[model samples]
Target: MRVVLSCLLMLLFVPDWMGEPRLPLMGKRAVVRAAPIALDAAHPARSRVGALVWLGGVRLTSPDRAFGGFSALHVARGHRVTLLSDGGNIVQFTLGPDWRPRAIAFGDLPAGPGTGWAKVDRDSESMGVDPRDGSVVAGFENSNMLWRYTPDLRRALGAAAPRAMAGWPGNEGAESFTFLPRAGWGGGAIAIGEQAPWPGGTGRAAFRFTGDPVREPNRGYRFSYIPPARSDPSDMTVLPDGRLIVLNRRFTLPFTFTNTLVVIDRGAIRPGAVVRGREIATLAPPLVHENFEGIAATREGGRTILWLVSDDNQSVLQRSLLLKFRLDAPGTPGSARP
Candidate 1:
């Protein structure tokens, strides 16, 4: 009886003497904000829509094997959505009635080393398509080279064509690009590069080039002070009002988030003038994902709708999230475009 009582007393008091206390079984919950007005509407052609679409919280082995790391996407002339994988492979998928990828076709990357220290080894990052000719211009990450492919995409299949542009200064790896029209310069393309090991910190830079791949002076300027700290400007799109919207990734140790969307005023930027920018909105991370890299904007009805996508980097801790948002024009002074 004495032994039994001693053992029971020890079991009851030993936990209290321990340095760490036992944790309670408290359940954790995620908070979901109320749906914005624009996203609440049901019509497919509503003025605007915004929602977060969970893209399989993990990488799909079969799909990724067929597509590689799909980092860039564009809507082609035929309404076909072309996805460019980081492994130098392009996949074309037909948009379904619900605006999802379907009926996929595989394609190839550019040939030959266009620029940088060594031959281009296929680090396709972002791409821009010529609306007039259907040709594709792809930017490689490490090589800092721009490659122009024929509309047929066959010329780039072989390793013989000369590089479209070469020997760009600084570690400006081309990441995002778009086409803009100018009066005397004709229709030119604007390419944006991500942060690299350069003199200045990683910031956004813009370049203007003629449609011809052989043209010299691919004339352009760099916007030195638009992006935020540790921001990896990944993708860009033009707003209806002729402004530029840049999506940036906020990278920190062990965490990546889509924290800011910058808007560059149309009048502030010129052919050679450096312009400042302002952050219009800050996006919330999807559940537990990071590395939001893709951005697209389109006008529905009369409102501007922004779309975003995350790069999972093939890590189990990350996921690809397709999110949408409607731009709410801010009335405050700081919200004004720079």
Candidate 2:
């Protein structure tokens, strides 16, 4: 009887992740329960056309423990999106006519160079898809490394830790990883650190890798990016026209959250140039904000669509939110055209 009691106590203390990882099933579909959420309680389901016109938003919940903690997002080909979580899981789903998630699919990264057991081992904070072949490059924070996967985001092809990104303060590493279409003088992939300040400089450290960082780690150049005051860079997306949209996040006093969207010209991104985005829109209290960590952009007929998602931090006090917006002023030089 004493042996049985001892076994029960051990089971109770066992960490939840001691079980198998929930890897993505290629053809399987999962369901994500969503409740319609308003961008602002006063304005309700809509946002005004300033820099970004609010479309609508939803609070997503799932019985699956693997859900939430979304760190980065990518609008892939078709009407589908690929979301990476801090838990080392990947969720792919198609959007229906009503802007709700449909045909959901989920999986874990098969394996990576870190080989750690916890989610932080795979802590994939950022992702960029290769347009030519649909391949993907994911940046893991705790490990301070990047891994490339096939288009389906299931298999690991290669991995690398760029020499320039050494000692990047662990959890702050690779917060924003993106691909700019013929960007820079010769074009390349870029990764920015969330809390890593530039050496002997201000702002954050951003790196431009000439080729695929996972493929060619030797060709990396460092740059500087200054986000809004009291905020840290979270995620970034390259627009269809080669513009860069960076997402900045802040945790205000009394447990409030704020987010800002800033745009930078494609021409401003040069070696050693300190690039600062033009603040176009802000998301704060009464305007629908959480730990808005992920951002992605797509172009419709005559409009540019933006999607913002929040990380619940897997905490009961927080919530997971997915928001949609449309950029109304693309030709404007700075900020949103009023």
Candidate 3:
């Protein structure tokens, strides 16, 4: 009886948002602030050796306490962005001509397959949108589930937990998700684990689910993605020519963040095959880096644009960052990397 009483008291003292998903009461519009930031505070004019050129960046803040923890992002055509928070909230905003955000909206995700109590239960870490119909698919970590929504991201369409994700760690289930737009390879959605080490000493586990994974869960192939040492895959997006660009991140003690952008060939990704990417660029200290957790790519008239967003972890010590770059190379697949 004494042990039971003690456990009950401990639970009472714990924070209400510990593991379950929590959201602010804000309906559609929310007040968010974006402050201009430089690629390198010390040397703002510095540039990397590869084809990527830093365009601009901003640090985002909000009055709402539940505003941070943005882990996944999808950038649409009109400078509009949809961000997924670790707290199970979706924030949508559009950038104006000056790169400042406007028309911000905040809302909670429709309840799905999870405890629905703690943030971890709704810890959505990766997201991708179908190019054909603009349908959105979000990957949740704790439950190892994928939730699909309409183009507007208001209603839940369907969800599923693939059998291939059976042994994935609850905390690191799905952090890298993207949709391949090329029709040559039978375009589909790909999901990869963040910290889930690959079996047989290869690397991280990855799955390519052909067709809608929520409907045809078993129609997919498994593979491996090998990133740089000590780093984990954060987000992935496809290039114009069928290749994939994956973002990796590593954090060191005392608050140091490092980010790497890798480009992989679609031909190298297949069942039982291990795909390794060529390091295209590295973002570290002295060149403006943060806990960048999201990545998206788009093709402009003559160049490829890359957009990245950071997860602030709702900590005062960190800031939500959005960085943009222009890859000055041909849009053909695999040409930008090599």
Candidate 4:
């Protein structure tokens, strides 16, 4: 009986990680449940939000500890949405018209800068997908690095830490990124640092990589972006017709975050040029709000759809939300305009 008790105690002390030195949900299937939510809590019928009309939204949650902290989002070919977390975790799923999720999956990045033993080693804050080759490029904050991965994110292709981003603070590096295809610039990428202001601190530091940022960091050049007052740029996407969409977020009292969407003409972006975006929509007050950090654009028929996903930060006081909006005011983004 004494030997049996000793053996049981030894089993309890076994290393939970089994010395694998990895993060959780390593390509493991994760189930996410989303409850329907409306744009206006009190007035559910009010859908008009600036230039956008609410199509649908939901509060997303998961029982797994590896979920949440989704800092970046990508919707590919109008078929699937991929959520990338700051902790190197990923959730991919298809959302139906009814707002239900199908073919859900959860995974972790296979490789990064560090040994994968610490959270900061995988502090990937921004991501962009290459439409030409289906490769994924992720920007890590604490390490201030960029990594290119396979389409499935199951393997790493290349990585680089550009000189243009070398001066950015560890925590404020490359918080927003997007692949800008042939906007008269021969298909490059743009990255925005969250709090790293440009020049005299009037705007955030932005960069345009002339090619694959991970593969060709040398061609990156500096630019300046001035978002709306009191807001920080979170995520960015290029419209189908070459316009730029940027998501800016601000923190409010009593623990909540507000969001604003801005549009910049593609021509406004240039080396050494200080660019600003026109505010088109905002989510605040009675409207559904959270720490929205990710945004994606897709086309459905003749409408350009905007999707937003929130970063919960893995806190009980916060919430993860997925919102869908239809561009109603018209203009670029291809099919969205007449």
Q: lDDT of each structure? A: 0.54, 0.80, 0.82, 0.85
For model 3 the TM-score comes to: 0.89
lDDT of 3 at 261: 89
- Error (Å) of candidate 1 at residue 9 is 71
List model 4 lDDT by residue over 68-139, tens digit each: 989999987635889999889889999887888889988888898876666767888889998789899999
TM-scores of the candidates are: 0.66, 0.89, 0.89, 0.90
Inter-residue clash pairs, candidate 2: 23-107, 23-108, 24-107, 24-108
Error of 2 at 72 (Å): 0.9
The collision pairs in model 3 are 19-118, 19-119, 20-117, 20-118, 20-119, 21-118, 21-119
| C-alpha root-mean-square deviation, candidate 2 | 3.6
Per-residue lDDT of 1-338 in model 3, one digit per residue for the tens?
99999767767886453543344434544978889888778876764425577788888888887788889988888889888887677788998769878888888777666645666667888888987788888888878898899888778999998988878988888898987774866877899898876666478999998877778867888998888989999999998777899999999988999998888888898887888898888888777888999998877775789999999998889989988888766454544442
Q: How many clashing residue pairs are found in candidate 3?
A: 7
List, residue by residue over 81-125, the lDDT tens digit for candidate 2.
Answer: 787787677777887768778878888777775555556566888
Stretches > 4 Å off in candidate 1: 1-68, 76-79, 97-100, 110-120, 151-154, 157-172, 182-186, 196-202, 210-214, 222-225, 286-289, 328-338
In the order shown, the candidates' Cα RMSDs to the true structure are 15.3, 3.6, 4.0, 4.6
The per-candidate count of clashes, in order, stands at 0, 4, 7, 0
